[model samples]
Target: MAILFSRRKITAWCVAALASLAACGAFVPAHAENLDAPLVLVVGYAPGGSTDRMARLIAERLSPKLGVPVTVENRPGEGGRLAAKQIKRAPAGENVLMLGNPAVMVVAPLVFKDLGYDPDKDFVPVSQVSSYDFALAVGNKLQLDRAMFLVGRLWAHPEEAVFGVPATGSLPHFFGLMVGDALSVQPQIKGYGGSAPLAADLSGGSLPIAIDTMDSLYAQHVAGKIRILAVSGKKRASFAPNVPTFREAGMKIDADGWNTFFAPSTMPQPKVQLLATKIREVMQDPGLQKAADALYITPVVSTAAETAQMLKAYRQQWEPVVRRSGFAP
Candidate 1:
């Protein structure tokens, strides 16, 4: 009777302990437990820009899946450098991440002599959300549709090769350089505040030529305000299949850019993986895919290792190009 009583007591104790743990959420699923805190998605661009829009889209879909609130914070300045610097200094426990692009991720550090942040040491690539290609667009004053015609006009009148880019020393700026190099014409590049003003100038015919993301110029191109001549892709972009790629147009320039979520390197590997997995799942949602298509970006699902490798390859590919350009911001 004593032995049976002892066995009963032990069994009762185990059940009680498990019940207590369950109440305390000790045995709850890891994802749920780990994500007790809400996520703050940071965008380093102004409201309504592509990066901000993307951040909002991801956060909206991610909130339901993680069962936690997700918010997008805009810290727009210096083409995302300011926001990146803030993220670099964020505490490991903070559930804050930045949607970064090549302007700050790739081109800024490469060109800025006094850049304050070190991406390689301070930021870990969580996952790439989407990729986009740049396009060389011209104003209606040019009335040219093909690349060869534009090249001929620019070559014959070298002064007319002036080009506008979103920012100086950015990927689009360098892509413009690549275009100039390919056509044996030295383009005089101008840096605008952002795509809005650049597009405005292009539409008004103040800017003879410009290089920026395909999406930035698509609406104007569709409205017949401006004409996109060539995109910096290996093949034609789906959104504008009628427009030729630089390669298809017989130019040797091929470049693309992506927006990726980057977290502080101090974040634990498991946490990063969990967040990455959730993000990829959100990106795979059909609604998200349709939204991305409407925004002129291709949804991407890549592991952290792959994102890191992509950045590594990007650095390698751009090192020589940067050195050759000798551009100083």
Candidate 2:
């Protein structure tokens, strides 16, 4: 038996299917259900990195809750701009997003002028993840009393001190610059490809001081291989409650680098709200918290609107810090 319908009848059937999804409430402010698109998460960094790990964590938990198949895609290079561009090109109704950090959003622009996308205009924030707390580490044989005292003494020394960083616009590099600016000295900085090389240099005493994140240095600090002087966090971290934060030391260099999830600039408000709401719910889960802690990350939960407000405030805050550090773009 042949089943056929007139053109008008087929159009009506298609319209009704979409209407049924809207009525089911699966996609937005109204929670409309749709068999239309799968939710996709785009990561700006290479796989095996923190951003990717975090993206997978959130996606795994958010899939069933959103009642859609969640897929993670890696589109690396250009320090996250590549992924950002991909997100921008996606259809507005498709759930496409990118996981990002300060390098893509804030630091790289200060150093590289030709970066193709604009954070403020090309993408919208979905969640503000936790700030990465940095630690000032030194080799064991250093003359300074501790990492903190060493920094103060190093600044006072007549010769410029040297520090190792992960990359030119990486958090460690900028943080070291900020610390030097605060101390009124321009320190020598060496940029390694990643954490492993930097650690090697630190161990070999070729690089005495390193400004690396707590998560990267926690294990070494516990094993007593490296000495931690000061932290970039506003408060002492739970794992290291004894160390002092930059604010506590009276310098007030609050450049705790951060990661925040984002979507294409044109994503509808209701869709943005729906996605942000789901991320917040997932981050709040105790099991997720434990998983993050195990991976040396801290879970941060916030609404998309709040994330936007925070970005605005942070841009204002970083302006002075960047200028003080002689950063020109």
Candidate 3:
């Protein structure tokens, strides 16, 4: 008779080995005392953007708490893959840390075949830091309902609506996919290198609609530069209460862009747990929450295991939507 081993059994064995190694102090504890090691926080965009600001904020708050000099390193190029590569190359047990997002972890690999690192396999997620909802900003070309109703109309519209996106596989790009999935209308998505170009094109009337962060939309909408048609959050944003969520509009759709921390996969579990725990602690700080609110972001916390589970679930939910968007890389 052939012997068979179940998947659970294999996982259990791996867990046991990791636990034993951790007890031996072979693994770096999450709260390792390496105060001199420069904790590099790598970001994928320019200094002024929301993502960069968030990274900086986290680094600032995390510095004193971790007793390390945390610094924000900007590597803004190639839709964040450059930063991802830089982190992947860092020596294990070093203080280098990469701020991972949906772009670097979820969508970029799907679009760029030559992506050198696998987020799911090459990096261990410490914790989910913050999240922001996206909005579909229309140019007042057509009067539409707030939130979900706008998505319905977009689905009903025969013409391919243009969604101005930041990068080819960034947050807005994925939001467009979910919109297309809900309404069954394939939106014509256009990618720009940065928000400046996107704003210019949208204001010039070349792009009729844009899928962007709530901050960008709220600022532009208030300035009469653009109009918000819908949002991709589960609930109405505090800044834009009139805008209904996809659930309220009778369409089941809710998604957001999240910022997380990831170290190289070879990182030990104890060190991973330590980082995850400390990040969760920092996320709950009232000061951090206030700072995050200013940027229209909400601090979210999750354990290392919980975040890993969340990533798996998100990938499962997005895979079909991505393939349908003709993202055949």
Top candidate (lDDT): 1
Across 111-211, the per-residue lDDT of candidate 2 in tens digits comes to 66677777778888998865578888887768453444765677678364788877755768767877887777778877788888887777676777888
Better of 1 and 3 by TM-score: 1
Per-residue accuracy of model 1 over 1-329 as CA lDDT, tens digit each? 45555888999999998778655434433544347689999998889988888888899999987788999999988878999888999876678888998778888887888888998999999999988889999999988989889988888899888889987777888888878888988888899987899999999988889999998999899999999989887777766789888888878778888999999886766678888888988888989888887988867888888999999998887777777888886
TM-score of each: 0.87, 0.85, 0.83
Off by over 4 Å in 3: 1-36, 145-157, 203-206
Clashes of each: 0, 8, 3
Clashing pairs in 3: 28-271, 30-274, 30-275
**Which 10-residue window of candidate 1 scores lowest in summed lDDT?**
25-34
Model 1 segments more than 4 A misplaced: 1-34
lDDT of 1 at 185: 84
Off by over 4 Å in 2: 1-29, 33-36, 143-148, 323-329
CA lDDT of every candidate = 0.85, 0.75, 0.75
TM-score of model 1 (CA atoms)? 0.87
Q: Which 10 consecutive residues of model 3 have the lowest summed lDDT?
A: 27-36
Model 2: lDDT equals: 0.75
